[model samples]
Target chain A: MTVTMGKALTAALRDAMREDDTVLMFGEDVGPLGGVFRVTDGLAAEFGEDRCFDTPLAESGIVGLAVGMAMNGFRPVVEMQFDAFAYPAFEQIASHVAKMRNRTRGAVGLPMVIRVPYAGGIGGVEHHSDSSEAYYAHTPGLKVVTPSTVADAYSLLREAIADPDPVVFMEPKKLYWAKDEVSLPVRTEPFGRAVVRVPGSDATLLAYGPAVPVALEAASAAAAEGLSLEVVDLRTLVPFDDATVAASVRKTGRCVVVAEASGFAGVSAEIVARVQERCFHSLAAPVLRVAGWDVPFPPPVLEKYQLPGVDRVLDAVDRLQFDDAPDPRFLAVSP
Target chain B: MTTQAEHRMPAVLPGGVPPADALLPSAEPVRFLDDDGGPAPGDAHGRYERPSTELLRRAYDAMVLGRRFDAQATALTKQGRLAVYPSSRGQEAGEIGAVLALRETDWLFPTYRDTMALIARGIDPVEALTLLRGSWHCGYDPMATRTAPQCTPLATHAPHAVGVAYAARRRGEDTVALVLIGDGGTSEGDFHEALNFAAVFHVPVVFLVQNNGFAISVPVSRQTAAPSLAHKGVGYGVRGERVDGNDPLAMLAVLTDAVESARAGGGPVLVEAHTYRVEPHTNADDDGRYRDHDEVAAWKRRDPIARLEAHLRSAGELTDDDVAAAGAAAEAFAADVRKRLSEEPVGDPAELFAHVFATPTPQLREQAAWLAEELAR
Candidate 1:
């Protein structure tokens, strides 16, 4: 049946709660309000309040309490409410939730999933529209995943829930309503693996979460101009699938990372650096990145210029400096 | 110890001058025992009794050992053994009282200044000193001891304790979590969140705030404007209580009541132990620059050990034999700790990678191997 990513996510939460009696879900406006995005709709009513519920509007408390709950027998799934809203809990995330299991010498297992509704293009104002994945992805002991498709959203979230460690499930706020054909209990690509969504060889676009669709669009746009571009969707940010990324980079000999977060010290920077490390000899030109400017998120009206999109990807592609590779037919004819 | 109650001669209310409002929960901390080893007329005080002779005797031993543990840890920091040590010297009554009040299954969460609580709870001193030794990981196994690591971050562990207690309740475990924070920690947002969560969920958690007068160099006055640290909980719907932190009997009695009430699903309680930090916040701090030496001297006059010992002696429950035995035990513990800490630290580069996750990720393995190669060179 056709399903939107939001429905798929709700279905995934329902399935995980059904499969495990110990799974507990709670956060700001998650129970009766069904989450600010309605992603947790009908959960508290369907499952008992104990299984799914709302929490006090304290972000640090939500994450810290989840860590303590995980230490006990419960596997807690915490909704971060919004991207910037998760910042209040960043201390707990970086200090305790990220370091608890490791600091305890494996005596405890943090079977916890912190769901962050992240990225932009949703017209969210101020703190609502932020791509804060870099903050979590940089922290060790956390598995960060951002699914771009309805099927992957359902599958990756379940896998994240099933894992015995903490996972930062970054949900693209814009993709919640994007529809696709997905079967329930569907098994898809495991986390930490990248897939080539649109295959070509001239240049490769590496993206995760919200930028995946843009990268695909850039690839299709490049195709009409006779420039073969391959789009590699990095569903998982940390523990990035170097094998897939390196193979594509080796074949294409060029890579452009796309992300909506600030460019400095971001996921895009990490990807570009890693690509250089793994495929340095195969590169025809320097790896490039198309990311949000290193400035505070602009107002909602002007956010379109700040958030990475197909135009920025194309701009970054234009910088690939692939002088050796044949130029696009349109560029050749114009010159 | 002197049998005469001359130590607190200044505080003696000879005119039968009952404290202004003994019936009401006074702004003053409740004291069940006077400085001279005599009862403080429990009729006017809140719900409390002089504990049994045997319990008080045991409590005396534990307090002495805890004091000795603090002294040794402090000396270790001076000796360059521990990276840093936050002593709980004057706050032993609250630390030991908080730990001894717990059942074996109940969890205890502590902050950096709470090494005494861990030692009093029967955790090995060397193991408890792990984090303070500059190791990357918390020294002890939290699961085995049913205790969370002694957190260094201000007020962060409070929420964890509440969470653990809440989870235990859902799992049908008759458990309550005792959390230890300082007066300075009351200013933190986590402190409020933990109490608020506990009160709203009706979780079994007892918050023990050791009002030790200071957080580093900052005084409690600078940290909070509430009537008292305990009163901070009242805003969260938590029943807040205060005890004479220097009085072992009061400390143990109040914490016991709080823990038992929590175990019975009576929800959360915030117990403020009105005490003072006898020493600097840490070995590295220049506490002298922040406070007058006379202030420290005054708190020492009401030393928890001397007063508790005098009280026990007056009751005829403590003898020279008990005193000698306790002294010998503390000395032995201190000696063993010195020996353990004096040893050179060994480097196991592999251990750095071992606990980063349940199983080392591929990236960590690669980094560990690279380190191994560098070390071999």
Candidate 2:
């Protein structure tokens, strides 16, 4: 079947709720109004008001209630209207939902998923376009997953729902309208596994969520330049597939991480650190990153410049190509 | 205790109970149990038949163990084993009473000081101590025991309780949520928001405010002008009541009614458990700096545990030997917990990055890899 990422997600949620009596879906405008994105348009009608409903304009309340419900044996999937709007509930996510299992010595589980529409492409205002996955990924006890393809959007979401832990499921708002052929499997796949969206050998490009498309574009452009770039989509953030990433990086001897979050202390920093550690000697050049600017996501007019693009990845590749040279930038640096 | 020191007393209502014939409704608190451990006149409000002997014994034992655990935690703070400890020494009855009123399926949202409530709910005292020791985040699974994490930020969990109640009611589940906060917490926006939400939605949640007369160094006088925290719920259209927090029987009676009422779809209730913080706010705080010694001594005479013990002994429900045995057992249990706590390995710093997400982002994986290498070096 061919479907947009948004439709796929809605179908995935509907199907999951249909399969599990305990499954519930709730968020702002998710009921009679559907969602702002219309991803949850018919859920309330299909599941009844009891299973699918709208919550008060309190993000914390939505998440906290989900935690309580999950504790009580309900599978709650909450939707944050926007990425930035999720900050109010971040405390609940970090202090309660994430740490509940470990804090209780595995006596309790937070089998809930929080769906957030994130990232910019449609020129959303400051609050709408922000990418906050790094913040969630930074906190322990949460599973941060983002899907780049229609199939991944459907399958990984079900996997998130089935996992007996809190999962932050981020859907790229910009990619919601992007359509692709999807095979809706009867069952969901396991989480924490990375997918090689494109295979190559000269260099590796690590990306996830919205950036996967950007990395694919970058890979296509790099291919024309005779650079065989391996594009790796990190399906899940918390229990990242280090083996997959390390294997790719080790083979290529060069890697470039891409993300829409701010460059400083972002997911890119973590990827760079890991690559440097595991494949330090294998590095043809320092692991490079193509990410958003350190400044806050700029106004829509400037966001295009702030967010990483195909040109940025190719630029990073250009830097890696000069690894044999003492690179003027490091001339005075001690080994 | 000092024969009512004859200094000009705050205007006392002529009758034993404040006269209802005031020009305006008097804000004087209502109490079912008196300071002398006797039921007051017109105390027919929500008295319960005495719980089974087994339940009473369990409650008493749990209170003793909770107190012991609190004391051991305080000592551990002094011994440099814990970062800090909040003592629930004199306020055990109110906490235990409320817990006893709850069904196993009901939920509890407790604050940092409600260790007694956690113990009454069958949570291992040592597990809570682990959080205080900074070895873990929250000590127990809120789902397994129908309790939320002990919220340190004042009043934050109140809304959570309301939300849970709303969810339960929406699902047609006859469950109730009891959220415990302090008098100081009543001042937080979350408290008012929670009360308003609970009332509007007719959610089955009880806002149990343990009015201990202070928020850290700030006295109750400075916290609010309302005669009682319970009155705050009135504006939100929720039933509000004040109970003798020191009287375990009285608290149990009121809480049972409140819990049952909520389960019956009677909407939210606001319960003000008027008590005192007999110890410093925490091991790191010094109450002497803000409160006088005399005031502390005065409140000590009205201690909740002591009052409950008086009632129990006078009623022939418990003997001195029983109390002594419970104390000895609690002390031994505390010692064992301390030993176990000491032997438990410290958490690995690398694990700090482990649970943030179910799967690590390529970026986080890199950071963890770097941290791993740094640790190795």
Candidate 3:
């Protein structure tokens, strides 16, 4: 069935709730208003306010409450109205929910999901457009999942909901309206698996969430120049699919990881490290990373430049193209 | 806002003789069950019952077990098995009494100091130790046991309890969420938020504030200008009550009523379990710097466990043999727990990287790899 990423997520949640009475969804504006992004639209009406409802304007309260509910045999899915709004809730995520399972000696499991609408393309204010996945990914006991396509949005979300641990589900706000033809009967995929979008032998472009489209566009641009560029969409950030990323890097002999998070300590850093470890000898050049600037996500006017775009991916490819040809520049930098 | 000076009225001392409305807001403490094991009528709220032999026996058992667990955990910390331990020695009845009154399915969100409550809620004693050992983020499975992880930050877990109760009420589940916080926690924003939310939603939660009078170095007098912690609940529009935390029967009666009210969907209730912490906040804190010895001595006279023991003996529920056996069992249990904790292996540092995510992010993998290499060198 064809559906937008938002529609697919909503449908997936609807299906999950239908299948499991234990599943519940709550957040600000999620009940009567269907969430700010309408991701939870019609859910409260269908599931009844008991299963899906609005909460107070407190993010930490939302996540903390969900932790308690999950402890009580309920699978709670909490939504932070926007990425920026999730900061207040970070304390609960880090201090309590994330560590509950291990702290409780594996006796307590937090079967909860925190859905965050992240990234910029919609002229959102600073707080609305930021990508803070790195913060959560850095945290222990949280499973971070971000889907690029509708199929992934449907499948991975279902998997996240079913997982016995807490999951931080990041939905790219930019791609909310982006449509794709998704097959009916959504299949659940294991967390930390990457999907190969386009296959090529020259170089590999690894990206996830909204950046997948940019990587694909870069691959197309590279193809026109007689450059075979492979595109990889990382469906999950935590428990990352290192084997797939390493294999792609080994096959292409060069790779660039693209993400909307800042370059410093971002998800791309992990991709680079894995490629270096598994595909070190096969590399034609050092693995490149195309990411947002270290600064906070820029305002709408400058966000285009601040975020990693197709041009940045191509630039990374341009730098990697000279790996086989040793030049004066390499020797000059050796000293 | 009232100035701090204006609120510095000396705490009205409880008279040597029990008052008519001691537990009520206007009175000091209504001692239905006195320290001398004599029966007295409760405040206008209700009359006191001469508890049955079985109930008194159970109360004694709970206190002994709570004390044993607290002692074991303290020993574990001293032996370097746990990172830190907060002794719940003198505060046993304040926690155990309320916890024992809870229904099996009722939720509990306890603070770091409420180790006894966790023990009462069926968490493996060793697992609770594991949390203090800092080997895991949560020491127990909250989902399976209806108890949340020990909240280190003060009062943060209170709102969670309220929220859970709210959710339970929405789902038509007759479950009550009980949250334990310290006097210090009442100063935090989350505390006020939780109370306000509970009042607004009429969530079926019981906010049990164990007012041990000191939050780390700060005394209760410095924490707020309100006459009492129970009065703070009035601002939230919830029914508030103060019980002599040292009186186990009083705590049980109040907590039972609160739990039942929550279960019946009546609304939230705030209970200020007035007690004192005989020991320092934790092994790391020093009470000498902040508190007076005279104050400690005064509170010791009202020891909850000792009073309950006196009551049980007077009621003929507890025999000398029963008391001796309970003491021996508690001591043996504590020794066994200490031995097992000493034998438990120290967790691998790399395990820190595990469980953050179901799948490690590439970046975390890289950092973990880097740490592994660095450690190898």
Candidate 4:
């Protein structure tokens, strides 16, 4: 069946609720209003209000409620209305929700999922579009995941809700309506693992969330220009799938990390730093990153210029020097 | 020139509703034992149990031990053994008395000033102060003690307590959480948020606010215009009440009722204890600068320990030997704390990164390794 990201996410929520009675969906306007995006549409009607409900316009309270609910053996998947809007709960998230399990010395563990509609592309007003995966990624106890495809949306969210820890489930707001040919109850790649979207030996383009499609497009466009490119979509931001990244970068000997967040202390910066440390000897050039400019997310019209796009990504890949010709052992498949 | 009826038209709501009742505080703080050595007014059916000889003895002993713990920890800070210590000296009755009302299954979330409460809840005095020692994040296992780490951030733990109480209720467990905050904690947004959520959810929790006159240097008058801090709970639909924090019997009775009623599905209660912070905010602070010495002297005159001793003697419930023995036990406990605190804490660079998670992530592992290498060199 062909389905949009919202439909796929709803299917996942439906399946999770139908499968487990303990699983609940709640947030501001998530109940009768079906959430502002309607991703949680029809959930309250089907499962009843207690299972899917609305909360006060208090982000800290919503997140804190989930933390408490998780402590009592409920798997709560709560939504933070928007990317920038989730800042009100930053303390509750960082100080308590993320640290409770560790503070209790693992005697108690939390199974809570925080769903944040993130990244730019939709012409939203201020405090709506921000690629906030970096904040959660930097946090130690949090498991951060974002799905670029519909299949992964169902599977990763399912797994995230089931995991015995807190997860920041970043749903790329731009991809919410993007349809993909996929079916439910089908096995998808596990969460926290990266998938090589396209295989090439020239340069490895690493991206996650909204930038995955841009990376793939850049690779497709780059291939037309006679330059092969390998694209790795890091589905999970934390638990970073370093081995997969290292293998791809080591094979290609050149890397470029792409993300929508700014270059200063971003998710890409960490990925690039990791690649530099592990694949330093195999590098033909410095690992470059294509990211947002170091400025606050601008108005809708300027966001296009602010965010990293396909053209910008290809520019970085084009800059990677392929001067060594054969790249020595580039063509050799490892046994 | 306007008639009374014409003047009242705009004042009337669309539905002709009466104006909102002023959010006045509960007029009288709950009191059981009297400072003048007798019961105060307002006991119907005489249903409330009299403070038993055994109960008075236990309360007296705990207060003495709690006071000694505060004095020793304060002295240790002066000697640079402890980084700093927030004393609950004047407010020991409210802290220890209320915490003693909780069961082992109930959770007690306290602020830094309530080290006395943590100790009374069966945590080792040294372990309770570990977070304040500037060495560890928190010392004891919360699961084992059923007590959260003494929260340094004001009012932050209020939500956690409510959440835990709600969670336990969801699990069909018979438990309630009692959160202790100072008067200043009520000014924090988290305090309002937590109380609001707790009341809306009808969670099994009790908020114990020790109105100890000052938060650092901010007095109640400067903090809010509310009649009492308890009155803030009225805005959140909570059962706001006040207790004479200096009266151990009153504090115990009020807290016990709040905790038990909550476990019985009575919803949340916000109890404001009218007390005083007899000491400085911490060893580093100068309480003298913020308030008058005359005020501290006056509050000391109403010292909880001395009042309780007088009540016990007047009632023929305790002998001179009993009070002396309690003092000796408290001294012995202080000696134990000093000895335990003098021993050096084993510093392992690895433990710094440990317990950040149940299983450390790759980034944490990498950072830990870098620290290890740096320490080795």
Candidate 5:
């Protein structure tokens, strides 16, 4: 049966809460209101208010209380409501949630997941739409994971909740309605492993979360133009799958990283640096980044110009600076 | 149509507690002892029972030792043995009283200046001083000691205590979490948030705000215009009370009442102990620049240790031999601490890679290997 990403995430929460009585789901408007996005719809009714409850509209308090709850043996799964709204809780996430286990020398490990509806596409106004993954991915102790597909949305969230350390689960707000044919209890490969969605030898597109679909669209567009591009969806960003990423880069010999967050000093920048350092000797050109402009997110109507699209990915693909290789697939297409 | 009673909104706080206004702190700070260590003029504090004679004796011993440890820690900073030490010299009565109010199963979430409380809780002095010694973030196992690491970020630990207490109650455990906050911490957003969450959830937790009159150099006057830090609790529906911090009798009685009420499922309580930070914020700080010496001298006259000793001796609960014994034991503890701290700490570079996560990431493993190779040369 077909399932939307939003439904898959709700199913994941339900299954986790059922599988382990210790798993709790809580956040603002998550209970009776079922969340503004309705991602937690029917959860409180099914799981009861004790298992899934609503909290006051205080972001820091929600996360800070989760930290305490995690330390006391509850596998707390909290929601940040929106991307930029999570800034108030950033101190708690970075200082306490991320450092508890390390600072305590393994005496305390917070088995918690902070679900943030992130990235842009759905014409969300200021503070509602943002790609704040960089803030969490940069924190060492946090496991930053984002899902671009329905199956991944379920599997990754379940695994994240089951993991001992805290995880920042960035649920792409745009992909919440993206539907796919998948059954329940769908277990994907464990975290820290990247998947090669589309195979090609010309160049590779490394993306995660919301950028995965754009990369795939760009790959399809490239294929239609007689150029083959490989798409590698990075499931987890922190324990970055060096083997999978480098192996793909070694095969393709060119790379373009796509992300919705601004490029400068962001996750895209880190990816480009890591790829070039690991695959420098096998490169056809410097790894390019196709990302949002290095500025605050523009108004909803103008966001399209700021967000990376197929054209932008193809533009970077044409700049690979590949040599005059014998195979037409390896040649950089002219604009 | 639904009936009016059915449509009425639920209470902001849980049931079984007194009305919100009744939970407000008294107009004047509550005191059981006068400045001279005798009973107060009226019986305003009579409602709260004084601690038992045995408990009072134990509190006296702990305070004497805690103050000695606090002084020794400060001296260690001057001698280059510690990175820094925030002295709790004059607040021993409240610190010791807070520790004594908790059972072994209860948790104590302390701030950086609560090293004396940690010592009073029977934590090894060296282990409790590890953060100040530049050895580690925290030296002891938090689970074993039921004490969280001394938090440096003010008021941040308040929510954790609430969370722990909430979880404990859910598991049918009678565990209460007592969080220690400074007067300045009451101004932090987390402080208010924690109180609101605790009251809403009806968690078993106690917030003991030691109104030490200073957050570093700024006075409490600059922090908040609230009637009192304890009074700040009423806005969140948590019962707020005040105590004379220097009077060990009052501190013990108030904290005990608050802790027991919460443990009995009466929900969280906030106790504001009016005290003073007699020493500088830290050994490195110059208190003279912030306040006059006369102010410090005036507070010194109300020293918690002297008042407690006088109260205990007059009641005949403590003899001269007991006072001398307490002093001698504290001296020995300080001497042992000095001797042990003279030795430099040995650090293992490998430990840097440990405990960041339950399982170190592949990237961390690679970085650890690189460091190992670099150190091999």
Candidate 6:
């Protein structure tokens, strides 16, 4: 059946809650309001307030409480509401949620999921649009995963909540409304594995979350111009599927890491560094990155320029230094 | 030019709002022991029942041992056996009293200075010092002991305690969590949030604020302008109380009431124990730089261990031989800790990658292998 990414996430929450009585869902406006994006719609009505509820609007308190609940054998699924708003809970996520299991020598494991609606493209005023995955990915103990497809949204979230560790589940806000036809309980590739969305023999366009769709669009657009672009979706960011990514990059002989977050010391930068180290001898040219500019998420009107789009990705692909390349598709679509 | 009728409005809140006096702490710190460990003046002893003689004697013994443990840990820092030690020398009453008030099935969320309480909870002295010894973040099994890792970041563990208590209530477990924080932690947002969450959810948790007068060099006055740290709870709809932190009887009675009240489904309670820090925040700090030496000397006279010993003897709950036995036991424990900590910790280099996640990511595995190769070379 066709389902939006938001609906798929709600179904995942419902299924997980139905399966495990210890699983709880709570966050700002997540109960009766069904969350701002409606990702948690119908959950509070279906499940009692005991299983799903709203909390006082304190981010640190929300995450900190999850740490304690997890310690006491409860699986808490919390929401940060938006990407930028999650900064207030960074200390809790970084110092407590991520380090609890390690600090306790595996005696205490916080099996919790901090769902963050991330990325910019919906013309959100300011704080609503941001790519904050890099912050979570940089932390060692956290498992960071973002779903670009509706089916993965249902599967990855379930797997994340089931895993005996803390996971920072980044939901691309722009793709929440994206639709796809998939069955319920669609168990896709497990986390830490990248999937080749559109295979090609030319350069690889590696992306995750919102960038995956952009990379796919770029690949299709490049195809019309005689350039064969392979699209790879990095399902999980932390356990980065190096083997899968390196294999694709080696076959393609070139790579372009794409992400909505800023390139300066961002997840894209890490991906580029890892790909080069793994496939250095096979690389035909230096691995490039198509990422958001190193600036605060811009105003709504100017977000189109700040966020990585199909043309920016093609621009990076154009720089791959192929032996006999067609006229630059980047120049044709360059703004 | 507003009229009285215009000024009046219908109340939006639900009925059964608790009286402010019921939630607010006592006007003055409660005490059952005077300067010489005799019955306190006025109605102080009438307000709360003194703990049983048996419990008081147990507290005295634990305090004696706890004080010695604190001293040994501080000395370990000087000997390079521990990286640093936050001594709970003068706060033994609150540390031991708080632990004695709870059952083994209940949870204890302690701060860095609450190692004394960890010992009271029967954690091995060597394992308790592992964090300070730089062997691991926590030395003992938290799941087995029902004690959280000793949190260092101020007030960060408060919300965790609230969550644990809330979970216990939901699971129909009569488990209560006692979170130990300092006066300075009351100013933190996490502390306030924890109290608010606990009260709103009616969770079974007791926030025992060891108001040892300072968070490092910052005095209690600098930390809050509230009448008392306990008074901070009333705003969150939590019952608040104050006790003389150095008085073991007062600490035990107040904390026991708070813990039992919570376990009885009376919702969360916040008890602020008025006390002083006779030592510096940590061994690396110089107490002289923060406050006058005379202040420390004055608080030293109100020592928790000495006061408890005097009180127990006056009540005939302790004898000279019992006091000597407690000291002997403390000495033995301190000796064992000293010996255990003297040897350097031998940690597996690969352990650095363990526990980061249930399943180590490929990146972590790769990094661990690289480190292994480097160490082998």
lDDT comparison, 2 vs 4, better candidate: 4
Sorted by lDDT (best first), the order is: 5, 6, 1, 4, 3, 2
**Across residues A131-246, which tens digit of lDDT does each residue of candidate 6 receive?**
98888998989999999999999999999999899999999999999999999988999989999999999999999999999999999999999989989999999778988899
Q: What is the C-alpha local distance difference test score of each model? A: 0.86, 0.79, 0.80, 0.82, 0.90, 0.89
**Which lDDT tens digits does candidate 6 get at residues B77-100?**
998888888998899889999899
Better of 2 and 3 by TM-score: 3
Q: How many backbone clashes does candidate 3 have?
A: 24
Contacts from the true interface found in each model, as a fraction, amount to: 0.75, 0.26, 0.47, 0.44, 0.73, 0.76
Highest lDDT scorer? 5
For model 3, residues B164-195, the per-residue Cα lDDT tens digits are: 77657656778888999889998887788787
Alpha-carbon RMSD, candidate 4: 7.1
Structural similarity to truth (TM-score) of each candidate:
0.94, 0.83, 0.85, 0.91, 0.96, 0.96
Which portions of model 4 show Cα errors greater than 4 Å? A322-335, B1-24, B33-54
List, residue by residue over A10-103, the lDDT tens digit for candidate 5: 9999999989999999999998888999988998898778878888778889998999899989999999999999998988999999999888
Worst 10 residues of 1 chain A by lDDT: A326-335
Write model 1 residue lDDT over B1-377, tens digit each, in one string. 11112211221124564422221234667787776546776552466776777778788999888888889998898888999998889998898898889999999998888889899888999889988988776778899899898898899999999889988888788999999999888899999999888877878899999999998999999998878888877677677788889988888888898899889766788899989998988888899899999999988988888989988888788899999999999999999999998987675778878877777776788899999999899
| CAPRI quality band, candidate 6 | medium
Candidate 1 off by > 4 Å: A324-335, B1-25, B41-44
- The candidate with the higher TM-score, 3 or 6, is 6
The interface RMSD values of the models, given in order, are 10.0, 11.0, 8.0, 9.2, 4.3, 7.5
For B1-377, candidate 5 gives per-residue lDDT tens digits of 12222212323345554576678888777787887788887875858887899999999999999998888999989999999999999999889999999999999999999999999888999989988999766888898999998998889999999989888888889999999999888888899999998888888899999999999999999999888888898888788998989899999999999899999877889999999999999988988888999999988999888888888889988899999999999999999999989999777888787888899999999999999999999
Measured over all alpha carbons after superposition, the RMSD of each candidate to the real structure, in angstroms, is 7.6, 8.4, 7.1, 7.1, 3.7, 5.0
lDDT, candidate 1, residue A192?
70
Model 6 segments beyond 4 Å from truth? A323-335, B1-18
What is the per-residue lDDT of model 4 for residues A1-335, given as tens digits with 9 covering 90 to 100?
89998888998999999999999898899988888888899999998877887776788878877876776668999999999989988888888778877665565678899999999999988888888888888877889999998888889999888888899999999999999898776557775589999999999999998999999999999999998999999998877898899999999999999999888898889988889999999999888889999888889988899888899998787667666444332357663
Q: Candidate 6 has which clashing residue pairs, if any?
A: none
